[model samples]
Target chain A: MTGTVWDRGEPRLAGPDTALRAELRTAAQHASGNVPVAVATDTAGQVLEGMRGRAFDSAAVVAVLDGDRLRGLVTLERLLAAPAATPLGEIMDDAPPVVAPSTAQERAAWLAVQHAEPTLAVVDDAGRFAGLVAAPTLLGVLLEEHDEDMARLGGFLGTAATARSSTTEPVLRRLSHRLPWLLLGLAGALLAAVIVGSFEEQLGQEVLIAYFVPGVVYMADAVGTQTEALVIRGLSLGIGVRRIAVREVVTGVLLGAFLGGLALPLVWALWGRADVAVAVALALLAASSIASLIALALPWLFHRFGKDPAFGSGPLATVIQDVLTVAIYLLVATAVVL
Target chain B: MTGTVWDRGEPRLAGPDTALRAELRTAAQHASGNVPVAVATDTAGQVLEGMRGRAFDSAAVVAVLDGDRLRGLVTLERLLAAPAATPLGEIMDDAPPVVAPSTAQERAAWLAVQHAEPTLAVVDDAGRFAGLVAAPTLLGVLLEEHDEDMARLGGFLGTAATARSSTTEPVLRRLSHRLPWLLLGLAGALLAAVIVGSFEEQLGQEVLIAYFVPGVVYMADAVGTQTEALVIRGLSLGIGVRRIAVREVVTGVLLGAFLGGLALPLVWALWGRADVAVAVALALLAASSIASLIALALPWLFHRFGKDPAFGSGPLATVIQDVLTVAIYLLVATAVVL
Candidate 1:
């Protein structure tokens, strides 16, 4: 049981597991390899004496190792409370939460929070103790991830620093960070204009049909935004769109039916045009149902391509939802009013 | 020198500081009063022995107090490293990060992260020691705030739990959380329709004006959404909207001019209608410039009223911006194109 060697170099790998090391950014990258370690057979007093003059990245928890393999973990409090001769093996938590080095940082941090652990242990593919991610590092990661998500969702060009500096940033720098998305949105807006213009003759025949274009487009966009928020957040927490698609789409349709049902009578009462009202209601139902699909699919596609799902929730998704909504609304209106 | 009182009740106040304690929900509410405490003159050996059988909410940092007043702080590692007979005062950090008990939880957490402290000390108004907010509690607070911001920005009725459960929640429960905002959006959309209908005569004369409605509205919404994201995030980090307003509005106006200049020539080339193109470009300029103002103002107002600034970024802001954008676009078109 006293086979542990106090080596500070990288954990010696038993085999080359390239697939597990392929992730460019992972828990291993941020973990510190300088935490305290001891053998299971060491008594509490012995470990404490060993730690006295040694430097460690974190001493909140001590890792018990067999050669290079991680065996168990014991918090400092537990060690200090035990009798001087108590063996670490008898006092250690055998089932401490552990993650592979390849795990995503966000997922690792989430696991630490779930387990209420102050530190996270990274185990390599061969079960060797790699390092520990201390609480401060995890806190920084959570804050950084939150800022990145906000920037992406807010249509910045994937710059987390912008969230803090945008308020004080030079106008030119601010414009540069924000213009790419707005330009793409400009292109999308022009495309929506072209789509709406193709139906100019229909609009000229009965002008009331044009009145609901913004209303229908806004509803679809609103519904899609809610779904995008959910899907993006879910993806970050390791929940895939595939797992949520069925329920979300159902919720979208149900929302559509409810809004459309309310809109039909309300439009009839206010606008005094039954056909136009019917068209608006039908378009609401179709546009909203499709909005959910587009919202779910875009994030899923981005995630599949190894991009942040947050990128899918920006102006790009809104533009897509807007154009489709316009086409669906007009098509429904044309069929109903003509 | 062992004059420390080991009372576990609330810190004995020296005077009534009711004004400082008036906040309904603050750091004091979540702070644990069960943390370890010691006096400056106590020896490290004596303190360690005293902590042997104690049950503390957190022992990561010991609060040094003089009667009820907090004096300094010392980490457990430092205590362990000091010679057994060394006075705690000689080893303690004279300055530790502290917050008034009435401080906002987010701000307190931010300070903790800024100082790289594993724990936060809460000092009551009479300079009395309240307790410590441990690392785990701060982690929980940051995650909760992130969820709440996402839900509010996503238009989910201020429910942070919706972020996690929206994927698995029943359709009815999902709808209940989401529909209130959508319904408000519907009302605003209808109001926009009515506003656009008011310009029906102008639209009938030059039907092209109606084609650019969604384009103008979308661009304004996009711009406003960016500003809202920045301001709301800034507000959470304790930066007031007033501090960000000037630069943000300038950025908005600059964004508008750039987009408007680009659109002018493009719309003219595509539609070949000089007056209609001018109206679209001008409306883009005015709507975007105004979008920044409304976006900045709404969040600031909500924050001033003691509500989360995130509440202002949802459908409520979108609807306001949409209606105003439509009216401005159509009004400009009525003057230029009609």
Candidate 2:
């Protein structure tokens, strides 16, 4: 329960545990069926008399059904305002949104919110009434999904599983949860060293070339992280990667040019080496442009594979940017300065 | 609306724009006053009659008002099942959760969700009923706030404001939104170079020292980012930084030791230099521990200042960790290798 709380909430509708292709049937399990219901032909007097004999869970809305098929819905307020002799059909909202059990849970929630309905009707494949997803459950799912997205982007493996437990979980459990990504980071760090070692001759000839290694990598990472954040969020909001691809590429190049343009003068003034400054500027330009593309592509690729797009963000992306930036900086430096 | 789309909703009750110190009065703006009301002495029939005459904004529940004082709340479902002659005072929920106008909006939302109430009642400082915040508005605010948190953590300067526009924003607008942070990153990159420049002698004496710069800094940033994400999220969930401080410190040390342990033998095996390997390991240990502390402290400090805790995450935290990591690596390298 401590490590796997999300699975307890109705597997398919629950946020973090939801598969990439989860549907409304999974979410319907979380819906509350404990509501008042009446036959579509029932009059207000008959419904009121039946209601008096039965205990209700949440009486926010009363469903009017024809056999097992949902016919209409009557909000408690509307029901109360109706005269006793009025038939339920005369006052019920005949067009309340109904979702098939196979609909995507996110789409279902979106539709519910857009219609300003506190509850959503879930119907079976044959259009029979299934149940209602109450406002509280939808709110919980939305909030849980938000947390899961952030956790995935943050690159913590078990952190999403233990999200609620993070605050009060024991220290050992916290350590255990965060260690998986840090271990992956270790492998990336080693690869970064191997990449730098490939340019050892350049470093030996001009030691100053090594000084800007962190600078170039950090800038590239800064730019990349921004794009990854944007892309991940955009994907969740239903915007496709192709829509923002061109603008991001242009921004990346422009950002690179502007940042590199400023750094050229600064490096030249500080180091008194024109070749080194040129190398730094060119590397920055290359790294920035490459980082943005990588950031955009990684998330898009993950999504294309039916994975959470957030899986492509955070430490994994940062390490990839770092290795590339170092290789780019050293290669450009060796060519220009050595 | 182009830049300040968030303001289109009520200023105070909306999510992202709320200041850290914001109180209940702001959230009350989202509350609807269009509910059936009775003087507590009125019967269900009178309340029902009154409800039918008005155009209600939200009819989830009825507020029993006794001379502007919130006497009790009668949910629509409860009212429907009650006999017409039952007095409002006898059938209403006498102790529904009520908050003063100064209650924090987030707290109010939490209370509403916890109580499974579709709306929240806000009372003034002197206990007069302000209004009832409907479910739709609260749900919208929560989702908006969640998006803002993610945007801030992702390091895009105007991304939170332009969240909905990220996919569709023009190239220039995207550049403008991202440049402010990248500019700050540029400054930090320059400082990282300066820090590396200060270690010129050690790097010149042994060029291999420069090879691990990116590796060490990258690892530190990776570690720091995990802490930053955790601290930012924890703060938002009302978990105080001090509560998790000790565990985080210990976790950082353990993680550093583990990563450094694995790294030491690898560096020695690849480079065949024990001094260099030892320096790398020790530097990793020191940098990792320091990065974790900085990550935890920055977000806590930002939150304490009534600023968004997310401001302490992303590129800002990463850059700060980079500077310290580089400084720590070189200082240890100079001591061990030279």
Candidate 3:
């Protein structure tokens, strides 16, 4: 039920080793070569007869080959729409999006999605036609990629393995999958404590300073998360980080100003401390703007370091945001409230 | 570049109204009825001839109809593999997953993914065939749904509207989109401050108690976020909340115990205060466990209310976790140290 239930072409079994490796080629498998093929000179009538004589597994798109080299592709829809006497060359999409057989499965799926094609043609290094990746295989790749991204963002140990595992997979397995990030978070937590401890004198001067620590950190994290989500999805959809940098930063500052404005009055009304309110408002403005910038920069940094952008989304980014927020909040409290 | 580049059947122009509404029929555009459909009584050979006469935009799946009454579907793959003399009735998939035209677009996409089908047949109330939803349409829907889910989790204003807008969308527009959640977060932040203020008497008794507030809150939020990601993806994959509830809870507790165990000694060593250490560790364990429960329950509650489960993921969950983490940390610190 784990893998075969959604079997398009690959039988993805739920096992410990099902974790997709970082290699782009790991996702691409050899196609069955069962799709219908025709020579460039074949007439629609001749292609129709050839199609009838053979038991091809998929003929959604007929590959037009010149001996071993693919020249073009003709969707079955086009073939059916054409007069039987028309030559295949006249109706074929001559410039179909072709990819190397070793291309990352995710990229291959993206190419198909970008072109809105249900089938993709794979070519070998020498420009020889390998086979067609059917719609199901492409769909499976898309779904798997989606799961992997979500898993990375969730801080799972291995996305493909854990996502495939039944809910009842061993507790030990769950622990092993989750502990790495939680441990990283633990280190961040300790650092937060130390940072808070450094401001002990300031905190002692004004007990109200501690009241807003969690609030500021949470808000920064929230703002940062929105940026992370946008950047991750945008990068995948072909929008580069450099394209939206200015707009995102400006949005961050504006968001800070608006949220801080609302927060200032509420804190003052509730606490009756003008200094504390000012400190809270200042911290909010600073932390929020910084959080948005960090959110955009981290994913871009991960991408530059040859990592998935999602690697920067979860605990790692949140920890950094928390530390900065804590420092900003306390420093402002020291200057304004103390 | 609007729709032709992605050439999925619909030409999705980048517009302010692209956010998919809650209706399913919005995504179900009229299929050009140009796909090669046939009556169940027609022979494959006859259907092939009939297909040659019409201009089909897609023939990946041939609808077997009886005077507009939907009979079954025969994939082009299977048709290619069958003897041409065979009748459509003998080769058709009789039990295709059919949805009403009004079914939610996301749900329709899910049904297609779960069934591993490339084409979906939309049937009317009396079971009359509307038309075929081709593979490109299904792929588009999946990608859109993916974007929308990510946007909601990231706390975006309107997924379709904002995600499609170039990151260069006006700062005012960006502010408008983000301010709603940030505003919601501001209210939560003020409430957190008030919660902390109520415990000021206890905090004054031990100044060191304030150091762990941000750390504790940050760690619980990290854990809760992991759970929220899993539950959101899990629910979409057809895993019911009840099935994984117990396992998730146990995993959360075990995570809490392990992290808290490590943190206890570390805090004690750093601060030379066993009482403070014990208080921090106890709060971590309790808050971590509670965080997981809240994470799971919030999405479930939203799902129960007929809302998108992702609505429970970002700021709302974080805000709730923050308030509770602050309360628990201070209460534990007061009990242990004071």
User: What TM-score does chain B get in every candidate?
Assistant: 0.92, 0.80, 0.82
In the range B25-126, model 3's lDDT, one tens digit per residue, is 343453434456677777777776666645666778788877767788888767766777888899998999787665566667667766888888777666
The C-alpha TM-scores of every prediction are 0.93, 0.82, 0.84
- What digit string (tens of lDDT, one per residue) describes model 2 on residues A1-338? 01100111221232343453352224466555666777666776566555542334455667788877889887765665677677889988889977765554554665667677777777776777777776666666666666666777676773356344665577677677778887887778888888888887778888888889999999999889888888877776567889899988888899999999999999999989999899999999999999999999988998788777778888778788888888888889999997
> Local distance difference test, per candidate?
0.82, 0.75, 0.76
Which stretches in model 2 have alpha-carbon errors above 4 Å?
A1-100, A114-117, A120-132, A158-164, B1-26, B36-50, B63-100, B124-129
- lDDT for B81 (candidate 2): 67
Ranking by DockQ: 1, 3, 2
lDDT by residue (tens digit), candidate 3, A19-113? 33333333236354667777667777777666764565567788888877889988877776678788889999998878766666666767787
Candidate 1 off by > 4 Å: A1-24, A41-43, A83-86, A160-162, B1-25, B39-50, B80-91, B160-162
For candidate 2, what is the recovered fraction of reference interface contacts?
0.58
Better of 1 and 3 by lDDT: 1
Which should have the higher DockQ, number 1 or number 3? 1
Interface RMSD for all numbered candidates: 1.6, 2.9, 2.3
DockQ of the candidate models in sequence:
0.62, 0.42, 0.49
Off by over 4 Å in 3: A1-22, A25-43, A55-57, A63-72, A88-111, A121-132, A160-172, B1-43, B63-73, B87-104, B107-111, B121-132, B160-170
